[model samples]
Target: MISHVLIAIISVLLVAAYLAAVLAGNPVYSALSMGIAFFLTALLFVLLGAPFLAAVQVIIYVGAMLVLFLFIVMMFDLNKSSLTPVRFKPSTILSYFLIMLVLLTGFFVARSVVRMPSGFAITGFGSARNIGFNLMHYYLLPFELASFVLLVGVFGAIAFIKNRRGT
Candidate 1:
């Protein structure tokens, strides 16, 4: 009973943090909110009996990624006085509408296709050993592809910096 209540409270906090991240005008506030959201997500993973995932969420996302994001935002030297109010042009409004339409359609389609598993408790489901085995065996290609994508992004960023320096 306590666990369920804790989960519900953490979930509410997670949602609130996410909303704050999305709605915040200042980049720093947005990053901080996102960090809170990530931390709450990690707590949710722990509640679901996935300690490994929770650790990864806290270490990789909240620790590394959010720190990197905050660093980048700080490096940009954004001036609050220079920030202009968002103008919703017709094209922007239409694009947002179209994106929402697609997302809603996808949600409904996915809901029809996917069914929730009956069993909630799965021992060793998120263990490091099990995760390693599955990643190396079942999901090796996707994992490699993701690494390759990150490598490409790093290279692209380096090239962009070099070009900027040259110009």
Candidate 2:
């Protein structure tokens, strides 16, 4: 009971912090809030009995991705004057309404399916070795593609900061 309460409180705090991040004028604070949100998500993953996913979420997202975002934000030296003010229009309202409609439809559609539960069935090995084996066997192409995307991002960041000719 206590654990459930704590999880619920933390989840609410996480959402609040994410909203604060979005509204914050400072990029650095926004980055930190993003890190907090990622960490909270990792904790939730742990509570759900997926330790491997929790670790990956922390290491890859909170550790690497959020740190990278913070580094870039700091590297650019963004000032308050540089941050653009947000404006809401009729289109924005329409888009949000559409998103809510889709979400409600999904909830109703999923209700029937979620009630049916199959008997306990576990097949896949959750070990690192098994993960690597499957990745190499079936998911090799997509894995390679992701690596290529990372390489492109690396080069793109480097180029973004480089001095251009013909100033």
Candidate 3:
């Protein structure tokens, strides 16, 4: 019961942190809030009997990804001249409408997920060795696809930076 309470608290804090990140005016504060959210997410994983996943989440999401984002955001010297707000075009109304609809649908789907009971409490579930084996066997394709996506994203970021600098 205590554990469940703890998990619930962490989950609430995670949501709050995400909201804070979204609503923050300062980029640095947003990144810090996201880091807190990532940490909270790792705690939830640990509470759900996935310590290995928690460690990976901390190391990858918090340690690597968040650190990189923070560095990039910090490196940029923001001022009124460089920090212009984007103007939305009337032609993009359909796109915005579609995105809003998708977000609403996702909210409903996520709401339903809260009531679902976890029945996959088997032994060795979410263990490092188990995950390693599954990665090598059942999830190899998806794993490779994710890696490919990350590689493409890295290239995209590089390209975006070069273009922004008029290189």
C-alpha displacement of 19 in model 3, angstroms?
Answer: 1.9
Predicted model with the maximum lDDT: 1
Whole-model lDDT for model 1 versus the true structure? 0.82
| Residue 126 accuracy (lDDT) in model 3 | 79
In candidate 1, which residue pairs clash? Answer: none
* TM-scores of all predicted structures: 0.68, 0.59, 0.65
lDDT of 1 by residue, 1-167 (tens): 55676678788888899899999988988999999899889867866877679889999998899999999998997987957788989999999999999868855854565433434334366767777889999999999999999999999988877865475
Over 57-160, each residue of candidate 3 has an lDDT whose tens digit, in order, gives 99999999899988988787765564657778886888999989986885585456444235433335777877888898999999999999999999998887
List pairs with backbone clashes in candidate 3.
none
Candidate 2: which stretches are off by over 4 Å?
A: 1-6, 76-127, 165-167
Model 2 worst lDDT run, 10 consecutive residues: 115-124
Off by over 4 Å in 3: 80-123, 162-167
Candidate RMSDs in Å, in order, are 13.3, 12.7, 13.6
Instruction: Report lDDT (Cα) of residue 148, candidate 2.
Output: 100
